[model samples]
Target: MDSDVDESLDIIITNVVATFRTRCHLNLRTIALKGINVIYKPEVGKVLMKIRKPNISASIWSSGKIICTGAASENDAKVGARRLARYLQKLGFKVSFSDFKVVNVLAVCSMPFAIHLIDFTKNNRSIASYEPELHPAATYRIKHLKATIQVFSTGSITITGPNVQNVAAAVETIYPLLFECKKFLGK
Candidate 1:
């Protein structure tokens, strides 16, 4: 039954956001001028750097904090962060890679059946909030997993959690509640 559920749910990780520190100050202006595929936004006080291998984008701050997003997996996120730090090292900064952490993971999965959003919200009012006017999807949060699951009428779910394990656990935790509100196709 667990295998069946896992096969059906098919959670696909779409994005992983991770952050790391260089442990040294970075000169944004110089990086923008010398770095490849870099965009320096002075107003935002960060430089955006893009790498092709892992297809990730990183926001680098002068304070030496870098946030990497768009990685498909946690390992990719770590690799992307390391690559970004190496780029800074080549630019003459005393870059020391430390404090690398995966802060958020976003995944998408589709239920085998359509979801009755209103019914689901009604059944789990305390944890689920539905506002059709403001958003099309009902937002549900799992406190223990520290994950947020967004359910749409089309049976698509978007999950954001601290890590991949938590995201997957959240799907399992919410499945029964969602099954109760599953739409019946036949009249």
Candidate 2:
């Protein structure tokens, strides 16, 4: 964590999405989802299973691809994936939890001071896109951190990207820039 933005910054892990390849073909239409905490939604063409321990929902498709979401941490995501895989195996499917990957991690935090999003976007057009009519959140695509920062007028930000390790890096990178923008706007 950088000292500049460490004072008033609070990062909360909202969700961690993970993907794991089971390397097995599943027949969603014919598979018996009985005795498991799963609901087959025909409209969505997927079986959604909820894992209580890690607190995540696993969406199983006919392709044997599983998407685990709502895990609070990376480890929880992995555990959630494993839990889903084990449950499927018990249901008579040859499953493997190999190639597990974290798709994206979402975190929310607030800035110490107010942000002047309009002015910030104008001065940093190359890094930001702010079209209120199109989208209320001003998005900043920081390449180095490989994160998309959605900044709002209320100074609260949503950071989404592949690497959760970059959360601190993101705070360090954006907070100063936001502060400078606020100062420039005499806020």
Candidate 3:
């Protein structure tokens, strides 16, 4: 059997939202008309641009800001961002792929066994919130670690937060608690 870190849990980045300082105000309509696979929603004032290499969706705003999503890695996100900058530059826009920042990191992992969400939430009431009415799964907010993990009965965990720096710490902190809440014999 593989180790816990390697088998029981695998941190798979699902989506990475990255932002860059283009420093050039954009016209969504113009870019959309010039861009490929671009959708301009003037009502929303954002142009949705899709690229194939990194397979990301870039929301270009008129305020010189771009939000790139659907990337599974930081490098992929940056690559997609730079590609957008180059595309804009090609359209005669002053673009700079500077000040790149990862605004949000969303990842998922699965435990070897199922988790008793009710019991886990009850035990960690101070740090967890079970709102099945609002959400299909239980949302656990570990504020101290700057992470909000959505736990499902299948032992699948969706971890979301603004600080990627705390990811390792949050995973370490939660794994032990998850073990305690593990449903026995695949119950």
Candidate 4:
């Protein structure tokens, strides 16, 4: 494909999952009471919190580990994680933000044409699997990039990877194969 086609294919990041640790333990009960927009589950021993600025949701464990999700970008994920730690600090916890890292990124991209799902999966059986009974989309795995792509018959693909670069690479790598099985409309 030409560079124009490649450039036109845009990868839209939908969610970013990040994780961080506080140096000290967190009191779930205190956070559930003192924190805003929090849901405390005593049975699970964890707290769920939401922040609006970066549009993130956090899962807080008493062990000082926090997992933040729903951010649209890596920077947003980091910012959201920091905000979570700050919230803990405001709650009277001697919190130290450490080991902050973006664990996973979810993105979507649409192809120019629809795909023949069965044909595509059969051609790439080693890396692709399609079980309509189990799920609508076919799952394709790229071992080297550690990325998983869910390809739909309607030309929409959902990709998840460790980072943005890998996710973009996975799309580029699969575009040619998808093109080969493109369904010709009105045929």
List the candidates' TM-scores in order: 0.95, 0.88, 0.89, 0.95
* Total backbone collisions for each predicted model: 0, 0, 0, 0
lDDT of 4 by residue, 51-159 (tens): 9999999999999999999999999999989988987898899999999988999999999889999999999999999999999999999999999999999999999
After superposition, the stretches of candidate 1 with alpha carbons farther than 4 Å from their true spots are 1-7
TM-score of 2: 0.88
User: What does candidate 3 score on TM?
Assistant: 0.89
List the RMSD of every prediction in angstroms: 1.9, 2.9, 2.5, 1.5
Model 1 lDDT per residue over 1-187, tens place: 3453555678999999999999999999999999999998999899999999798999999999999999999999999899888889999999999999999999999988798999999999999999999999999999989999999998899999999999999999989888888888884
Model 4 earns a TM-score of: 0.95
Instruction: Give the true-structure RMSD of model 1.
Output: 1.9
Q: Which ten residues in a row have the lowest lDDT in candidate 3?
A: 1-10
lDDT of 3 by residue, 1-187 (tens): 2254455457888888999979988878789878789999899889999999998999888999889999988889999999889999999898877889988889988878788888888988888878778876777777777788888889888899765656656776888787788777734
Write the number of the candidate with greater TM-score, choosing between 1 and 3: 1
Task: Give Cα-based local distance difference scores for all models.
Answer: 0.93, 0.83, 0.83, 0.94
Per-residue lDDT of candidate 2, residues 79-98 (tens digit): 88998888778877899778
* Residue 100 alpha-carbon offset, candidate 2, angstroms: 0.1
Comparing 2 and 3 by TM-score, which wins?
3
